[model samples]
Target: MQFLVKSARPETLKTATLVVAIGEGRKLGAAARALDAASEGTLSALLKRGDLAGKPGQTLLLQGLAGVKAERILLVGCGKERELSERSYRKVAAAALAVLKTLGGSDAALTLGELMVKGRDAYAKARLLVEVLADGGYVFDRFKGDKAEAPALTRITLLAEDTDLLACERGAAHAQAIASGMAFARDLGNLPPNLCHPSFLADEAKALAKGNKALKVEVLDEKKLKELGMGAFLAVAQGSEQPPRLIVLDYKGGKKDDAPFVLVGKGITFDTGGISLKPGLGMDEMKYDMCGAASVLGTFRALVELGLPINVVGLLACAENMPSGGATRPGDIVTTMSGQTVEILNTDAEGRLVLCDTLTYAERYKPQAVIDIATLTGACIVALGSHTSGLMGNHDGLIRQVLKAGETAADRAWQLPLFDEYQEQLDSPFADIANIGGPKAGTITAACFLSRFAKKFHWAHLDIAGTAWVSGGKDKGATGRPVPLLTQYLLDRCQ
Candidate 1:
């Protein structure tokens, strides 16, 4: 879809649809009141007769009313204008776009951005409008031959005055880039495991950086991983027929001398829990286990497009954990790239294995800061549910910065304690440490495992097990989370 900012009156703009805001108690916004008067009290009569009640997310459609030039008028509820918060404003915009989807139209002019949303400027409102529309229209029909045709709503013009027109345009552009990046991540996450394995992720990264001078792609195969002493990562991949790939995406957008920000992602394409198998009831959803890697690639897509002046490197630790005779069995001790040994008590806890090697590898980048995202632990789901990711870090400043970024992006993260007591949970008599840190504080212990390898630099971990994807019959898909958070963090750094 195309987004534009137009400085025109709702009655003057000729479009297939005209969207205006209506407050609770049947109060019309300035543009809505003007349009209603032009329509010869048609909206007033409907409100008087109880035909329309303005409540949040409630939309009423009027077709070809008297003296109205637009083919249709959509009045979306703003829900008590004086009490409108950012959440409510986004709800109103989303609801208006949802209603516009069902209407038969090729284009729309939205005046809803003119509505008063406390603490949000015109740019923020315009950005939200574009972002919400793009996200709502998303559909994963790639595998379906009988997919439905695209919606007719192709062009969306946000009404803004001359003073705010530039800001509106800038917001629309940023929103498009961010939404497109998220869509890219969602598509990769939603694909079947067979089609989106380690090799596929490598190819996608190479393809993404084909002609972009600002980005470079590199892939380390099993041979290179072995040469680099990535035994812990290789042990997890030994069970599968597919070779593991350590994918690296280096984006040089800032000055050459600038230290890069590093992002490491766990790319467990198909996690069957290895020797420790998961229940078969929801095994299909395991295809989304690589959402962390998807998010890294997704964020890179946005950064490259926006041409932000900041160096960023994304490392994807891609592998498939399966059950086979060659698989790393329980109690197997494997050494990592950092030269630390791990006793794998349960093979199901494999995410930390790959991440440890990658975090060790990330030290070579000489990063200013490092953040690793992973579908690491189910215990995180039990703790934070699906609303937030579990955050743990070794440094107070980095963790606080990341938590603030998550909050700003609305992709929240709840911090878990990384006290020395949690590190004690990984105690093992045989090796340097144990992969499975008992059964308590699974999330923090998992972070503790990675933290050992990341002691050389400032590091933070994001356990995205719960927020990565939704599990249900029809609503099952990747959420493309933490991309927003990571992107916001990088943006803040650039400033």
Candidate 2:
């Protein structure tokens, strides 16, 4: 849907609908007050007629323009506006979306609810409303057909005549940047794995890096992979004819003296589990294995568009794990870039192997922080379910910051413990480390394995296994949860 900021008055506002928010039981302030003058307190009288009490998310449809100039006035409940927050905007925006969908409204202009803004002023409220509109309008429907029907809202025009539209330009720009990055992720999730292979993902990085001064993209082929001793990641890719690729994207927006923040993502285009093949049922869903990569790409897009003053780099390790004659089997030993050997006890534990070398490669930059995301283990799915991403990091302050940002962004995170006790499970009889941590702590072990590669730095690992993709009767494909979480975290750090 389209959205704009306008200065037109409510009476003169010409649109399919004009929505005004009422704080808790209080009637509308401006629009409703103007509307009440025409009715001679009839709206308040009508409330007595039905003995109706307005609360959060409540909506009352009133007709006619007595003293009011607008044809229709929508009284939306804003709860106790004084206690409202950015999160509250979601509820208010949701009510607006519901109104638009019901009225088949083509365009809407929402006044910034004064009650919702404390000392922050009207511009913040306008921006919050914009965020709410964008969020409420989001629908993951790549697989949906024409027969399916959803809310067809075309535009959301924000109105606060006195407020400077871009009062804090950074946040407003960042929001659009975030939206663009999310769009890229949605595109990747929509495509089938057949078209989004290891090479394809690598090519995407190269395309982003091509002519842009903002980033330098590099694609490392099989020769480079073997040269760098990425045998752990290569073991999973050797099974497929398509070679593995390591993608590096560099964006230097900060001062030269500033240390870069490193981001790593697992880019498995498809996973048939090599020799340890998965069941045929729901196997096609494996296409979303590259969702981690898609997120990295999304983050980069946002960083570039917002022009944030932070030097950041993103590493995507792309591979397609399949079953073939040459595929690495159970009990195979593979060497990593860190000169550590891994005993591949479970082929399904392939994501850790890919991340190990990718994290080790991060050391070259001496980054201030390193974070890796992957659809690593089903154990994480069991632990956190689909509502939240599992966060395991080395730094306490960073974890808290990320958690706070997650809450504000409405992309929740629950921190999982990373202890040394789980490290023993990775002890290999014939290798330096075992890729499979064991049966009990699958997620922890996988994280522990990746942790080994990011030594001497504040490292965080997000296992998005549970939230990466969903398959049910109506919904299927990547959910793109932590992209916003990670973006918010990055923005916080950038500050």
CA lDDT of each prediction against the hidden true structure: 0.90, 0.77
What is the C-alpha lDDT profile of model 2 across 15-118, one tens digit per residue? Answer: 66778777666655676665566667866676666433557778777774555555566777777656676556667777867777777667776775445544
Top candidate on TM-score is: 1
TM-score of each: 0.97, 0.89
TM-score for candidate 2, residues paired by index: 0.89
- Give model 2's clash tally: 1
**Model 2, position 261: C-alpha lDDT score:** 90
lDDT tens digits by residue: candidate 1, 159-230: 998899999998888888888888999999999999999999999999999999999999999999999999
**Residue pairs with backbone overlap in model 2:** 81-115
Where is the poorest 10-residue window by lDDT in model 1?
Answer: 112-121
Clashing pairs in 1: none
Worst 10 residues of 2 by lDDT: 165-174
In angstroms, the error of model 1 at 142 is 1.6
